[model samples]
Target: MHTFAPKSIASHWRLIAGLLPWLLTGCASAGYQMPDLSLDSLLGSDQAAARGQPVADIGVTRCDQLTTHEDDWDRVNGVPPVDGEDIDIAAAIPACEKALAEHPGHRRLQAELARAYAEAFRYDEAFRLSGQAAEAGSLYALIQQGHAYRYGRGTPKDIDKAVNAYQSAAKAGHIGAMNYLGSTLYQRDGWGDRSKAESWYRKSANTGNATGMANFAQLLLIDGKQEEAFPWFERAARQGNAFALQQIGTYYAVGGEPAIKAPYTALSYFEKAVEKGRPSASVKAAKLFIQEAGDTSSRLSESERQAKVLYWIEYGMPKLSTRQ
Candidate 1:
């Protein structure tokens, strides 16, 4: 992506230096090695950026166009698929079924159909199709199998089997699978290894996966390494990750070494995150408007400020209630 100017790069290094003590101390206490914080390491390669570039269409088949998951490593033409929850399940199920019928035994079509069926709550069909697709060497299908086992969809819930499915795909170089495996292990309570989870998250982040970057950054934040996590969150935010956008907004809201407190900038990011499906950010944005209105230095009239605050509260109220 976006190129950093020389001045901005220098500023970032200064911020990193200010936070180094916390990072080193945190890592030492946790018995984990410190991560490389150099700009080169964080920026990665041009290829990694290219990998995340989105294209308008894949033009493979109607089913492929409709049901390809956004996180699939094998996505052709850099086609950006809809998120699972955003997929038009009714349309996708029929479209994928028709496509599979037209091209019998196509593994990718099988996996795509499985995804649509899963969204439609046809768990048995989803599980069966995903199994067939996985046997036919579809890495994406393995993730579906993992989800089915993990959530007890059409079969008994089996965390071990879920891990196996995700691990297999991860070992085979599926970026999304690495993130999924890390998440599965991290949430497993007594059996979970935070170290293993971190490593898996790092692996996925190194591959330029947006979800991985966000997850890894979150883990770092939890470990009291906010300085180290900031850049990763920025990277994921640039890739349009909703969670990362919200996190960046939060960082801006609180003045720190890495982020200067800028209410306007924070509000901009919060609004962007809300547009990207992070409803909680709406509350943050609304609060900022109210804070700004009360600021003696702010130029906006009281009425204008009140209107902005009202707009955000009303817009966000419905979503906040539904968020867990």
Candidate 2:
């Protein structure tokens, strides 16, 4: 083996200079975190199932084990659910089909297969199956129908229809549906109703919905009610909501009525948000490392600080496009 020469200081500086533009671009765009309209948010967890409400048997089939969304209301004991993006659509579609074939006329299986189809972008199949399940009184299926109409997956985009479906499910006391209704009303281009959105969010939050708590808290933060928002953010964070974790990090980074300035603690929360799939936190974490490096009173040596910065840049660069 041949001995290798270490990189020169100039080379290191040159590398950092090359990376600076990418880092700054990510940081600049990080200010506007888009509202989450992800699959998990759309197909939220089933509070009724968690409360021991009677639901169709979902654990008996291999399809259920493979395609069950992590937030799905019904889960089989000992079998973990996967995130929406984590679903293997090709495999899930076939598995669900086989299960439905075995248990003919099973509305729940239809809904599950519909979800798999939706994930695969086979919106026509998703719409058909979800419609069938909705007719059979599956609130989750109704929500899926709303999503299809709202986004025009396989049907014409109809906000009124979407709102109607969400309202029907919300009337049935679906916490996720309430949150969806709030999001829809709050973000509906020119006709958004802030008062109605706030009302729905408050309803969901009162029912202990983590997403609702986070959404309501965001509105409070926007209105400069940091002290009031902090508790709600903390509540959501305790339930492992990534957005709430990031918000808490922001509060900690800047001294405020409820949150004291704590850079190290803030950095930890940012890292946690990254772990929870909030890529925007990566830039925040990197910036904090750079700030710590520049502070002469900090305990880290110059070389150590440089290494940390490099590590963060490399770690966060690939994730910048997945900002949430």
| Best candidate, lDDT | 1
As a TM-score, model 1 comes out at 0.75
Task: For candidate 1, write residues 93-170 as lDDT tens digits.
Answer: 889899789877777788899888887788999999988776665667778888998999977898767866776666
**Where does candidate 1 clash, by residue pair?**
none
The TM-scores, one per candidate, come to 0.75, 0.77
lDDT of model 2 at position 116: 90
Best by TM-score: 2
lDDT of 1 at 127: 94
lDDT by candidate, in order shown: 0.70, 0.68
Worst 10 contiguous positions by lDDT, candidate 2: 11-20
